[model samples]
Target: MKRQLVLVALTICAVLPVAQAQKVGETVATPFQGFAHSAKGSQLRDQVNDLVALVRAKRLSDAERKAIELQEKFEASFDRKMRQYSFQSKEEYLEFKQSAPEQFEWIDWGYKETLQMKAFIAADKREFPTALSILATIEKIAPASAGTAAERGYILNQLGQPENALAAYKKALSLSTRYQSQRPFQAAALRGIGFALIELSKLDEAEAVFNDSLKIEPANKVALNELAYIRDLRAKR
Candidate 1:
């Protein structure tokens, strides 16, 4: 009887692991999932278009405007994520794997920094608190981010915290977004400064800054609109 009991115990132990093998479903981030649930590339593309359309529409009421602004701000970050399974700059990136392969996760996360800044600006324009939250998140992601402080400054300026905003923008402007000259990218940093000046209610200074952005990017809609708007305001006077 003791021998029989031992056999049964061993059998039960052997089966226990299998019984416990049922993995609990991993909880996925449901962010923006309500817009569309399919993870298919085409589906996501469609959803993004829909989102852009909603953002661009001028028909929104004040409350709707606020909501759309918040959504668009969060989206700016998504534009920068260069999805890949390896580092962006192969030469500089591969050195990490050779020296510290254990720490190296082979994933190319490229250029999304600027996108985050734009997103934070969008969100903050709608709701100040949300922008603050996004800024904190950017700081955590890249402590020494070239554009992080600039983005924070923009947000603070919008929130009526001009002193803090100035500090943030100064920090950001000092940090470099180093790369080859490009219309869209070059305009971003300049635009940030221009808008920060706007927040400070320095209209003349802001107009000049926008002009700088336009010089680098003649087709930049933001700078054009802002310059035109300022001129219109002046014309009315």
Candidate 2:
């Protein structure tokens, strides 16, 4: 029962924006906006934007179906284009500097955001494997991204892998400190860690982790409610 409660809290914390049905078939705005300066970037961004709109505005099954097809085609298009430039290896992508510098720069900036949006769609659909795959690709592209690590941890937790979730959260925290501007993200990572500890029945450790998270943001309702729930459970014991 306690574990179920913890799961509920985690789910609420991870709740993503779901577009209303009335908004279906509409192109939605995202953080990855204005990425259409170049012809190639514009085309790819338009397609991805459409996919994102479908994912958020329609039902989950329909959204997932479309997202899967779009992802396949999107990857294939990139693969075909890179092959034309002899960029066979992912590592050899930097060679684009010689062939298509503009494309190189555009992809370097856009792919990360594109992959992140795809990962968000997968997570929204509760497709853990797809979400993790997208996140792993992002990790390779941007290794120092604490946000990616924290999101990976959230997916792992949703899949009931608390041990792995805890490890991912720890990595996020370590990386967060190195990127000072990510302190707020670090607090979220801390809250995730606390939830993982709770799942593992490490109550004392969980309490400390939640308290530390609350210290980072006093009005953190997630941490505050968790603290109260922990106390209630302990008192009942």
Candidate 3:
């Protein structure tokens, strides 16, 4: 039992999902790839990188302040842009959206990606409540965001709220249906679900969820480890 618990702890550490800013060595791969092509978006990306640098330098308060400022600026810019256009009907709005998808991508980047950084900063500081509040705001603004839902699940799991985490992960899976190509997000959500189930002492269910996660991400070390742990657990039973 002690060994099983240790495995669970290791699994949690391995799968703690944190939304990170684009690091220097990493490539920017997101659904909003086009947003990076725009001048304003590129500027915002730079600001986010600066925030990341502050965090890396152990300037948590400064990073948090910068994150808040960035969020506010993004909100103001988004509102100003929206006020510049007026649509006569829903059809017209849909037409505009189809024609100018980048506009929506920018909005999504502001609400999802930017806010995610804020939440990550708070979480890194061990300010879990503040992190959760930021995530809640993201959910309110972008209800269909699978990433946000999965993030919430990870946070809630850390808070020892497995039931809520399970719900959040399941919601992420449901929201991810529209983003069929985003298998990594789906696998992450499934892994969160499995972790939550393990916390609930539902070993069999957790094993099943981990298997499903592995099906999505064949190279998922976390799921593979958890599956081995679960099998060991059952063997001792």
List model 3 lDDT by residue over 113-211, tens digit each.
Answer: 557667776776678898789888877655545667787788788888999999988897886664432224677788889988988989989988889
Q: Tens-digit lDDT track for model 2 on 17-76?
A: 222210221222342233223313344544555555554464556555655665565456
lDDT string for model 1 (8-68, tens) is 1111112222112111111111332232222112223333333333333432243244434
In the predicted model 2, the residue pairs found to clash are: none
Q: Which residue ranges in model 1 land beyond 4 Å of their true spot?
A: 1-127, 144-147, 176-184, 232-237
- Measured with C-alpha atoms, the lDDT of residue 135 in candidate 3 is 81
- Residue-pair clashes per prediction, in order, are 1, 0, 0
RMSD of each: 22.3, 8.1, 7.2
**TM-score winner among the candidates?**
3
lDDT of 2 at 140: 66
Model 3 misplacement above 4 A? 1-43, 49-62, 78-108
TM-score of 2: 0.61
TM for every model, in the order presented, reads 0.43, 0.61, 0.67
Choose 1 or 3, whichever is better by TM-score.
Answer: 3
